[model samples]
Target: MRKNEDNKNIAVIYWSNSENTEIMAEKISNGIDETGQKADLYNVSQFPIERIEDYDKVALGCPSMDGEALEKNTFEPFFEEIESKLKGKKVALFGSYGWGNGEWMRDWEDRIGHTGARLFDEGLMIKEFPDDAGRHACVEFGKAFASF
Candidate 1:
């Protein structure tokens, strides 16, 4: 089953300030690897918007920031830049939250809808840093996404 999986077409991009969201991103990548698809992991700043077409599927992660919004300085701008490129692509979203409900993720899901991108699943949100169970969940989410 692991004989011919390619690694070039899937990417996991995330932005984290407190490192909680980054941890989730790593686990999700682990899951994707488990499915025999080696996904590229990148911080938002490290990923160029022009490369959106290079990946058929993408996992985006950003923690809740400043009143339940995306981290403005980097991730928000990156997302805005790539929103148009997501049309017909498979996209998944995940992140960590320190407070409030998951309003940010819902809004994000809606935005992806506007672009005509197919969502791999509902947004995955974890409060604060993820414990062992949460980590396992992230990995499973990644596995499913890769399989999708």
Candidate 2:
């Protein structure tokens, strides 16, 4: 595990329509900061993917929509573009959902795994909005990813 003195660069990019996912992103970034790592948090729509290569670890969050899946507009496109660049990088995933088993997360984890990035945690999922526990889990996920 990486120590706080390693000073890794971490990024958290997320897409949220109801602000739930954004909340998780913030918690995750806080966790990264706790590890003495620099963390950049950005909304998926406004994030600059071209700069992703500058980070040592990346954490992504996206809510499930229309069943079990990621929001199509911004999250999918952004991930597609960065997928290849993620090989051998440490990555973490988190999101919120209204229903269904966590199929979206499962599928997403598999997709990200295909890129050869190491997954830090099982990934977090909230039913609708995250409560205190979910937020804390997000933070822990970020810390673990940064330590990787």
Candidate 3:
């Protein structure tokens, strides 16, 4: 509802092997735009983790892999790269999962908490491709995250 962040920049970064998470990231970006803000979307490999401090807010996305865990190779290392810098940062999280009760998100949330970042809200998780409701929720999450 608030469009005061016209000049603010947000980052939506994610890792998606099947590209489902990419769609969610794009939806989050659309939500940020609804708030009259800017969102830069990036694949985890394409984003420079050290540049995380450049954005006013950040949205991180990844799919649950290898038993409801963050991807061991790319996303995990990228997240670890930015973990320390997250202290005092504003952040949101989203992901697509094949199954397993969203335990990966819970673990991720706990990690984010330990970093002292201000969590925008509960992390959004979608099973495989997000349905209409999931996409709507992602948009809402983006709008709220940008406004905050």
Which candidate achieves the best TM-score against the true structure?
1
Candidate 3 segments whose C-alpha is farther than 4 A from its true place: 1-7
- Model 1 Cα lDDT, one tens digit per residue, 35-143: 8778889988889788888888899999999999998988898899999999988999999998899999999999999999999889999999999999999999999
Sort the predicted structures by TM-score, highest score first: 1, 3, 2
Per-residue lDDT of candidate 2, residues 1-65 (tens digit): 23245656677889998989889989998888887876888898888778888767888999988
Clashes of each: 0, 0, 0
Q: List the residue pairs that clash in candidate 2.
A: none
RMSD of each: 2.6, 2.9, 2.9
Better of 2 and 3 by TM-score: 3
lDDT of 2 at 115: 95
With candidate 1 superimposed using the best TM-score fit, by how many Å does residue 20's alpha carbon deviate from the native? 0.4
**On a 0 to 100 scale, what is the lDDT of residue 110 in model 1?**
93
Off by over 4 Å in 1: 1-8
Tell me how far the alpha carbon of residue 44 in candidate 2 is from the true structure, in angstroms, after superposition.
1.0
Give per-residue CA lDDT, model 3, range 24-122, as digits (tens).
999999998887777888999999766887776889999999989999999998999899998887989899998799999999999999999998788
Best first by lDDT, ranked: 1, 3, 2
What candidate 2 gets wrong by more than 4 Å, as runs, is 1-4
